[model samples]
Target: MDLMIANQKSLRNLTVLIIGAGPAGLSAAIQLERYGIDYIIIEKNKAGGLLLNAEKVVNYPGFPHGVKGTELAKLFTSQVQIRKIIKDEVIKTGYREKYFETRTKLSNYKSEYLIIASGTNPRNTNVIINKSAEKKVYYDVINLSHHKGKTFAISGSGDAAFDYALTLSKYNKVIIYNRADKIKCLKKLYDRALQDNNIKYVKNISVLKAFASGNGLALTLSNNNRIVVSYFVIAAGREPALDFINSDKELENLIKSNRLCIIGDVVNGIYRQVSIAAGQGIKAAMEIYYQLNKENN
Candidate 1:
């Protein structure tokens, strides 16, 4: 059994393979469970995806007073406990005859259908703090949430930037710098942020350099301005988390057949919301069910 599992040719008789455990992938699993579909969901890192980084989620239905991002993630995770999510990374993917093959660090698996719910990764930036001060910068606030009376310099002008500002303001001062003069975040996040005296927004500036400054970090701006802060947060932007995927012509054509479904934040662009992602997952599962049932009959 071990030898057969180790062999990449040994296939798992699963109907569909989902590559993420975020809201979209989790919802797909929940729906597929109801339909009794033989499916496997794999997640490389945390099961919650971007929501794990959120400080507070106000828009998700059910929580009257709003819920923390991590809390929502926990709730999403609870619903999918019936099946285990493969906690492994998919290094490569390809289609094998009629099966979709995915190679992970430990093993490989193939299925009749594939769902790419890998979601989005932070946008790459030319600006990288040196290794000496690497720990002083972060993409999320999980580590810095407990620190009090410290200043944080956030780089971005979107909802995430303001969201990070609001999260950090609980016990620290936050300075947000935007490359352009206009703000891209919703008016509510901006307005609510203004109510907090700890948050400050600076427009028309870019982080040119960042290095170690005492026990913190020193940032040089595009206009030759500089600021020293306890930590730096990057809320710049995000792009599809499809770097590991190859642009195969055959795979691209599979979308038309619904055999390869790409759902959630990875394809949602600016509309990356939990509810929307869940809805897309349900829609994909419904279409998949119809196709599978038609074939079985």
Candidate 2:
């Protein structure tokens, strides 16, 4: 049936459909469960989103020694065991008068209220890299064991780039190549990395091309230089998964009305951190509860 027709019938029931099963989405699910609200969590990939690809997460609470991203995600998934967790990607979303419908690869689900916690996708590099070189490059180091004891190069000038370099430097000789003259990472991190012997800085360098060489790789620097490395990581930035949000005018209005909440990295101008995303999820859930209760009376 059509989305508008589905939405008209869906409003009588207060089912909340949450997109993405990252920290934010899981946190919201926990809140909804505590309030005895009916809800479902949908994830396109695994439960963790980018966290799944992180080697270790040191900043999150309750873990003094820090925890692996995948492990932390497992814990989050366990917390929302009562709610229906669908392992499918949301392709589109649309709304009618009082409800919204999200279309996924497997099936279509309707909800009276929707919360978008779907995170962002890693940005692609503009430089021309061969298919093999592209396969060797990664955005996260969760699978770093494959490139152990090898020389690695990371491209970008941000906190994520710095963090990736620092973490990988423990096992591999890491070199950071940035297009700009100045590094844009946190002062402390930049200072620390500068002092590391295993890490090298290549400023005012732009990668023009990359090609696979034997078991490793070769990169052509913009200055007509070549650097060979075993692994390359691109921490450029991220693009929001907001195609569904833009398709539905009524859903957008609901978001503006504060009836529907968009949290996590998919929302514009929000920092991409596990703790921050979880906090936003809690806030969205609380607001949703308050609004639902207020509407009933």
Clashing pairs for predicted structure model 2, backbone only: none
Give the local distance difference test score of model 2. Answer: 0.80
- Candidate 1 residue-wise lDDT at 65: 89
For this target, which candidate reaches the highest lDDT against the unseen true structure?
1
Using all chains and alpha carbons, the TM-scores for the candidates as numbered come to 0.90, 0.84
User: TM-score for model 1?
Assistant: 0.90
Which tens-of-lDDT digit does each residue in 1-297 have in candidate 1? 011234655556678999999999999988888888888888988888888878788888888888998899888888776456888998777775677777778767877888999998778776757877788888777667788999999999899999889988999999998989999999999998889999988888888778998888999988988889999999889889886677767767788788889999999998999999999899889889998888889
How far out, in Å, is residue 50 in model 1?
A: 0.9
Candidate 1 ranges with C-alpha deviation above 4 Å: 1-6, 9-13
Candidate 2 lDDT score at position 201: 81
Give the TM-score (vs. native) of candidate 2: 0.84
Q: How well is each residue in 1-297 modelled by candidate 2, as lDDT tens digits?
A: 125434334333447989989899999999989999988888877787778766568789999998977799898888888348888888777776566767778777778788899888888788788998878888777677455688988898887777777777877899998999887777977887888888898899988888999888999998998989988888888888886656556655687766678888787444677898999999888888888888999
Worst lDDT run of 10 residues, candidate 1, spans 1-10
The number of residue pairs in model 2 that clash at the backbone is 0
